[model samples]
Target chain A: MGSDRSARYPDGGDTGTDRAPRDGGGRADTGVGRRGFLRAGVLAAAGLAFGRPLLGESAADVVRMVGARGPDDEMTDAVREVLKAKFGDRRIQTGHVQLDIPTDAPDGRAVPTILDIDLPITPNSYVATYHLLVDHNPDIYLAAYHLTAGSGEGPIETRIKMRRTGYVRAIAEMNTGELWSAAVKVFVGLNGCG
Target chain B: MPSMHHDSSRDAPTLTFTMPAGAPSSVGEAKILLPLSVARDAVIDVRALLVHPMDTGFFRDAEGNPIPAYFVNAVTVTYGGEQVARFEWTSGISRDPFVRFPLRASREAQVQVVWKDNKGGVYQQAVDVKFA
Candidate 1:
């Protein structure tokens, strides 16, 4: 199983290629050498600067999803179901956001996704929460991110598993209760629901 | 049967793990990758990687047995002793979850990421942000 997982996500190793741009061209070694050294140094410096318990008890904040009325808008039935269940009666406008993803993803195990919201993150008005929804998947609610004004221009970059190929929707709820959404349809090959 | 794998190249810094004495061993180790250099008030990307199966309970093992659902349900990010962001995730997330979000680096502070699984297991890692 481990080998299978590795084969599926080849770049899952500590290649550090993802950090190339952040390093400011200090070193661009793709292999495990100079780049890896700097990565280790950064981690080491962070550890020494602030050492504390990694794990401890915390108040469990469990999420409960209840069904509700779907949004009155123009969208696919699958997406409407999700919107209805997640954000009922909230007018979900279709603008001010975009889903940055590949149109055709050959692999479904890890499809790179970026949700970019062109909104100001200020104390008075900011995107408070962003919900990632897939039209067709084992579960539609991929994730919901809560952000405050301190998050700056909230842009989320992550990898998601698509059971098949369908629309990936991102809905951002502002602090003023304004709901804005954007979606993109993707073609995915190779089932990644495993 | 969660396992921990640290890259051979990394120095393997102090990654504090808090597994209870009699509890089932959960997969340990997570890391926060910050830019080596950052200017004042620059909105930089804070990348985090967590090790977890994120099993969706929809897949079967090699022996045809159903794999139970196990995944990180919540991820909280705190900076300078204040909660900046929190994520509510489901099994739809891929294995070995990796996430990057933009954060304004106003001053030097400690950034901590906490990953909570559905089985009441909490895993976390922290890194200090220093301005260049």
Candidate 2:
């Protein structure tokens, strides 16, 4: 199962090529050539049928759906429900936050993971809260951390139990009414959610 | 079960900040392990270790005394001047938590982290981004 997913994503190498701009320019461009545009249009239309975001949506908009509403048993939906109750109508972007976990975990009893917030601390704006979530677990919501200006400066590291192969997400809320998030997919051989 | 008494002597929460040694000089006591690649996507992978006991206040000590709950309450991350990520932590987290995340970066930017404990102790650290 792990190998299957790995084949689909193919490490980070394939992601580079897939995201590379067709134009030979140093800047990162989201535009495409005429042929590529037509292909994207077709894909976008199909995406609509599958409830996926269209090409018109920004990357941030697409990324925000990482933990959007899903099945009641889904971890993403559980986290999304909590977030909606906490912060209504606030937009969460995909930057300045990282959720690190192995692509595959042979032992789901304890999977080493990390949630790092790389944004600098400022008097005017700073991180105020953190939400760590795991999908497919009996308890989708894993942990929550609240930080102030006096909290330590370092990433929060720990081991998490996974019931099955799923994604882990870390969401951070700032004092300035902004939220950031990051997620990673992991495949677990043993079920730990029991 | 141990006694449910609180010790007045060890009531204060210990606070410290550290970063990885070597390249990417750090400012102040806080340091971050950021391996930034200058790629077209420019996705920066960030890893940092936080020092905290994450005491749940549920277990009893050797003498059956209840340990006071002392955990990092919250953490926030910001890039440049824009708010990025924030975390609200609970006692379920383990001790000495390690956090890792990725941020989209194209140029040198300032990253900051602020964490607060249950006892109102706040610690803040800042680092500058460097590409390898």
Model 1 chain B worst lDDT window (10 residues): B1-10
lDDT for A148 (candidate 1): 81
Off by over 4 Å in 2: A1-76, B1-132
- List model 2 lDDT by residue over A70-175, tens digit each: 1111234355576567566577666688776788897665588766678876556656666777755555677765554433234556667665666777777777
Q: What is the RMSD, in Å, between candidate 1 and the native fold over all Cα?
A: 23.1
lDDT of 1 by residue, A101-134 (tens): 8979887778999887887567688878888987
lDDT of 2 by residue, B32-120 (tens): 67774444335556665666655556445656677787877677787776556666666545555556655556456788888788998
lDDT of 1 by residue, B1-132 (tens): 002422221332222123347743447568799988989888889999987888888767666677889999999999998899999999888778999988878789999999999999899999998988
Candidate 1: TM of chain A? 0.59
DockQ of each: 0.29, 0.11
Q: What are the lDDT scores of the predictions, listed in order? A: 0.72, 0.58
